[model samples]
Target: MNRAAQAVVMFLLGGAVLRITWTDVYLRYVKQGLRPFLIAAGLLLVVAAAMTLVYEVRDIVRHRGHPAHDDGHGHGRSGQLVGWLLLLPALALLAITPPALGADTAARSGSALATVGESETAFSPLPPGDPVKLTLIEYGYRAVFDGGRTLRGRQVQLTGFIATGPDGRPILARIMLACCAADGIPIKIGLRGDVPDLAPDTWVRATGQWIPHTVKDPVNDSEIPYLEVAAWLKIDPPANQYD
Candidate 1:
């Protein structure tokens, strides 16, 4: 790309990154622990773009009214065309940012439970409360790995969008992220027999207890956990989508 085009592309890229990180939007894709890195990377890219702009100005002044030739160094029309592609990602981020990962993503991923040495993890009592609030991942980890030992007889409240299971049944599902959107994993809690059917991506808060069933991942023969939903109501999607 031409120096001027390169500088503009860099500016847009950097600005796009900053726009997401400076606000809660970044939380939709990655963990909170990555805030610092995102901010730093955005700032560095912006600074580099600014420096390039200054260089471009200096070059223009030094060769006034005599633009540099197409020396196969991005001064040609072809270079400018390719440079425009850099704006695609920025425009998408700034103008048409995508919604958080939802039902479609969960359906594509076969497994709902992911635990490391779950058998060895010791059990702990539910925090003292009439209804303990917990993320879906937290509930899934404790229920699936510990055999629902900590969740037994305890009323827990979980929030997530509704997704349909393999058999086209409603399920309380949420995606957990280890780093960013690309590495998200879906977790689910089964609604009790009494709970009414809900549409896909319907955000809701369900209060319930662990049912302790062998929820094999239907797509794959994998063990997952489920909660016996007692009560639930529709709610707006949370500001942060990832756990």
Candidate 2:
């Protein structure tokens, strides 16, 4: 395309990437978070737009044989200047940083981009009373087969997101992503034994015991050392939700 058209196309493409990367559209529309790298890309886009604008104005003035002088003084340069002015918004966006990515909206979006299934798989032999560090994904895998058979009646620690249930109680939740953060699936565990006092999406380290019970889907349940609340820290989501 010509300079003007190319500039417009690039600007629009940058904006589109920003939207897809930051929003859940990355799941349904595309996959991946493009927001993290946009700052540098936006800078380059601004420079390219500026250069293209300059060339386009020059070309327009040369080709358009419009009124070079109205009242022997006015020139068609005014039209070209006005056209460049219209591109101000596009230029400003490249300079101004956008907002950070927002948390997933469960209502509007409904669950994560992916979903976990009831796998009939059990965990390997874990000694009793061992402070095992397990992620939400690991817990789900164990739940698949008899709710963690080998690790049954053992003490373990689990970490993940806090999802509120219908009764307004916090549930240990984590998301399983297929590709990037966009296509993630939410996994939940009813905090039966003990849980930390944390907000939704807040990361925490649980230091407690485990008790296994035969329940419905995700069959196994653990009795955490409810009283001994070790460390309740907030952190960013981990790279992988599933094991």
Candidate 3:
């Protein structure tokens, strides 16, 4: 495509910066292809801009010597217009710059907001009402590793995703993974009362007491009670999206 078109495309795609910087979606799926993809896109934008400039300059020179061809707009008006159009992409990027994905949203959004390898495993189980500093991944792992024993009737704060149970109850979930968020498996705590009406992708803070539970799963031989949440509040999503 011409320079103006190229510039517009770049602006639209620039939004991908948010995904790359925060979400693991591309890193996990595209893997080695990322660098090449960026390089190619960058090169295309640069070349388009260069062509637009060159054409504009040529038109200026051609019109300068010929009065018969001269319009009020001067030489190379079309090329200059195209060049100005190229600025649209840059302007679009400026207008809609990607917002930072804050780390705080981990509680409300899915485990996709946690940063892989950044998770903490040092969280020792605390007595109810204790101020526990726990990351999303650790909270998820412990809830699973301990088989809900650690969370029995304990007031704990956790950030993660919202998932639905077989009974159609909304659950506060976090996913654990060996790689990226895509591979992350979800674990959830059932929330009591009417949930805060948070949307599927929204991040929020959950402050409540944890109640350990055991439910008979017809599909499984053993009974399991996922963690039960006593109260929850909506808040922003965390900066990262994996762990």
Candidate 4:
């Protein structure tokens, strides 16, 4: 492709990156800590593109009176076509932002139970609250690996999308990302009592007590914990889907 076209592509790609970052859409694919780095990279690309475009315009103006000549390579058409193809990713990002990873991703990966070290087995007493809010990962760890030692006799709240368990029952599930969606692992908790018949990917806030029983995840053979859901309601998906 010509230098002008290359500059345009760079600008589009950079703009796409900036747009997502500005709107907090990047949280779907990456951790919050990477926001600054993404913003910087996007700005760099945009600046470089602008500089290249200015240089190209200056060169064109300087040579406006010269007769055009072409080397017999005849590669311009093919190169332009390839350049157009490269614009699709940028266009997609700008026009059709993809939804965050949800039930389908979680089901395929299976339940991921965090391994508790010997030191981790002795969990601290939970803070006093009628129903303390906890992340799905924390509840899963306490329920399965720690045998609900800290969760017993306590009501806790969890918010996550729903996914079907190995037994085809609804489970509250969240995707835990180490760095990005590509490295996400699903943490699932089986719902024992009065789970509503909701479609997969439906986000919910549930207040439940630990059931103190573990079930085997057929996909990965890891222990899956159960929560006796006392109350639950549908909720909008959070801005950041990953934990």
Candidate 5:
């Protein structure tokens, strides 16, 4: 693309990224830690846009008395093509802001193993209360590797979407990520005992007792756990979908 067009594209893309990051919009797509990176990237793009504009305007002034060419737009077909190509991503961002991954993503990658070499944790006791609230991923880790030792007999509540495994068995699943949606990993808690025939991606708060069962995670060659559902409260999707 010509310098001016390239600058505009970069500016738009960077501005959009900054806009999303500055607000909560970016939380749906990436880990919270990327905030500074998004800001830096956006600033760079805006600077580039300013520099390109200055340079192009100077060139035009230098040729102030020149005759116009037949392609009166002053841009070649190649430049237009490049500009359009660059526009695609910006346009996409403007058109549809993707919500965090839900049932569709869970079903697609249900069996993904979040492998960790044997690192045992000694968890502190749940705060002196029943129905301790837990992020779905923390519950999963405690359930599986810790042998459900901490969760036994305690009432716990977790919120996540209803998604099924490859075998079509339903689960309460949440996305776990180290950086962004691109690196998201699925953490699932198999649901048993009076689960409703709810649609996939239905958001709910599941209250349950952990009934520890030793089931092998075939993919990771490790043991995983399931929950004995006591109740399900249908709810709207949360502002944040990852744990």
Candidate 6:
């Protein structure tokens, strides 16, 4: 690819990065903590692209009357085509922002819960509240590792998209991201009691007590805990889908 083409591609990629990081769109792919780094990296790319274009233009002006000579590294039409193909990712980022991970991803992953290590068995007392809010991962840890000892006699609230269990029962689920969507793992809680039938990926806020009973995940044999939902309400998906 020519230097000009390379500069254009860099600019497009940098602009795409800045666009997503400037809004909540980035939260769908990465943790909130990484926003500043992404912004800095985008700015660097843009600056580098701008500098490159300036040098290319200066060189053209300096040699306007001279005969052109091919650089040893120059690739023919085939290489230019391949270089242009690299723009698709940048263009897609600019034109189409994909939706956050949802039930389909969770279901396809077999709804397996992440295993708690033996050294991580420590439990903390639930904070004082009528319906204590908890992430799906936190709820899972307490229910599976501690046997809901910290959850008994307390009504807890969990917010996540609904996913269907192996038995076709609705389960409350959220994607847990260690870094980004590529490394996301689904944490699911079985919904019992009088929970309403909801379609997969329907975001909801569930308030319930831990059922103290755990069922084995058919795919991985990881214990999936149950929630005796007292009440639930449909809600829009949160700004950040991962927990």
Q: Please report the candidate that would top TM-score against the real structure.
A: 6
- Residue 85 alpha-carbon offset, candidate 5, angstroms: 1.0
Task: List TM-scores for all candidates, in order.
Answer: 0.89, 0.50, 0.44, 0.92, 0.85, 0.94
Per-residue lDDT of candidate 2, residues 190-239 (tens digit): 56544556666666556554345322322222221111233345567553
Q: What is the clash tally of candidate 1?
A: 0
Residue 147 of model 1, lDDT score: 76
Supply candidate 4's per-residue lDDT for 50. 99
Mind giving the per-residue lDDT tens digits that candidate 5 earns over 138-208?
78778766767899889999898888754477788888888889887677778888685789888989999
List clashing residue pairs in candidate 4: none
* Residues forming the 10-long window of minimal summed lDDT in candidate 2: 218-227
Model 2, residue 204: C-alpha shift (Å): 2.3
lDDT of 4 by residue, 3-117 (tens): 8989999999999999999997899879988999999989998999999999999999999999978867887777789887979989988888778888887788867784545
Expressed as tens digits, the lDDT of each residue in 1-243 for candidate 1 is: 667878888889889989998888888778889999988988998999999999999988999998656565446667668779889998887987678999998788866574476354766788898699998878877877777888888889889999987667788888888899899878867666556477899998899888867567766556666677788889988888777
Global local distance difference test of model 2: 0.51
Q: What TM-score does candidate 3 reach?
A: 0.44
lDDT of 6: 0.88
Candidate 6 residue pairs in clash (backbone atoms < 3 Å)? none
CA lDDT of each prediction against the hidden true structure? 0.81, 0.51, 0.50, 0.88, 0.78, 0.88
143: Cα error in model 5, Å: 1.2
Candidate 1, residue 102: the lDDT equals 94
